[model samples]
Target: MTSLLSVTDLSRSPDLEEVSFTVERGEVVCVVGPPGNGGATLMECLAGTGEPDAGHIELLGVTVGPGDRRPPGLGAALRGEALPARMKVAEAMRLLSRLYGTRGLPGRLVDLLDLEPLLPKRFGRLTDGQRRRVMIGLALVGNPELVLLDDPTAGLGEGSRRRIEQAVDEVRAAYGGVCVVLDDLAQAERLADRVVLLRAGRVLAEGTPTRLIKLLGSTYVMGVPPHLRVDGLRDVRVLRGAAATYLYGSRPALEAAIQDLSPMSGDRVWSIRTPTLRDAYLTLSAVPEPAALEA
Candidate 1:
């Protein structure tokens, strides 16, 4: 089946390097990466706010190239964009709806984003989370066929982040369309139908959240002291962090490594749990070292 949105070999100087991906109908694709990894740049290119030095973007069968007008059905909520400080949320929504020629403020979107109570509040008076929700609503003004959100939940608290996640889900369900969200790995794990892991303006890995996690080839992760050594352990990958040294391997391998450890007075401490997408991201994005275990 043809994808709803396709980005091919999209490149920009010093930031994006031949980045590419596709979004299917009704699917939510999250581009996960650290800051300055080109995730935001990718969104800007797709939104037609930034031009790509090479390659092209296609949406709904329409090609968008450098200096081309934005496609008709594309909507974007980019970072650092703000509504007028004195404009009330309701006024802002109505104004964008008119600008986009949309019917009006969508009741479903208002409910999904919990914007009813915020209608009367000025943009400056609304909290960051509330303002973000309003921005998302503005982006959806015309029921766009493709939506691009850059770091939609950035700098939000855990509760606000969860609320945004829920809103994304509800909005997708209520209005069927393709969505592309650029955010951190944790948010990608929660919201992505397919995860695109980007690093240094390039794609490191792309797959479903489960598939990406499977790339780690480990069922469990054990966090031991950074100074502890497991010299005899095989088939385990070790990542040395400032706070803890994480060992990724199967359950039995970790158990064997634990048994081999010489009893240290009460000082020996370790923790084991299931591996997550963040663990996979860290492992894949890490620079190779002489002591690092290969998959």
Candidate 2:
């Protein structure tokens, strides 16, 4: 199937290098990476807000450029300040609809996003999380064929995050196109049909979440007391935190290593049954796990 959005060898300055990917219609693609790793820069380049020093981008089969023309039938909300400070929330929403020539704005969106209470408030007066809801709602105003959300839930409380996530889900259900950019790994795992993992200004890995999680295999984690001396432990990778040393590996090997501990009843212990997308990310990024650090 032809891609709805295709990026070829995209790069910019010291931030991005030869990044490339494709997004199919009705798919939600999440970009994940650490700070300054190009996730946000990728979004800006896609939204036409920033220019790429090299490479090309195609949205709906047309090349994107520095020209004033915006991609037709595409919607986006990028980082930085949002909305005119003095504009009321309701006015901002309506003005966006007018700009897109969208009529009969769905009342369900108002309720779905719980926008009623904030309607009369000015954009500058709303909290960061509230402004995020507005930004998401604004992106959906024209019911565009594609939407790009950059850190939509960044800084939100639990309730607000769920509301924004629900709005994203509704967009896919209603329009069947979305590319959600997120810094949070767990959120990416939950919402992504495909994931693009970036590190040090490059695309380190890209694939389905399930496939990526399997990169670490069927792993198990054993949490032992922080002070426990695990340097002598064999056939296990360990991640040490302030409270515990997390040892993980294939099931049988990990279990055998745990038995070697010969633990008493009071020893702190826990287990992670499935390897998560975050685990795969850390492995790919070459993070300094305890075992690697000791080596």
lDDT of each: 0.78, 0.79
TM-score for each predicted model, relative to the true structure: 0.90, 0.88
Off by over 4 Å in 1: 181-183, 262-269, 287-295
Top model number, TM-score: 1
> Ten residues in a row with the worst lDDT in model 2?
286-295
RMSD of 1: 3.6
Cand. 1 TM to true fold: 0.90
Model 1: colliding residue pairs: none
Clashes of each: 0, 0
lDDT of 1: 0.78
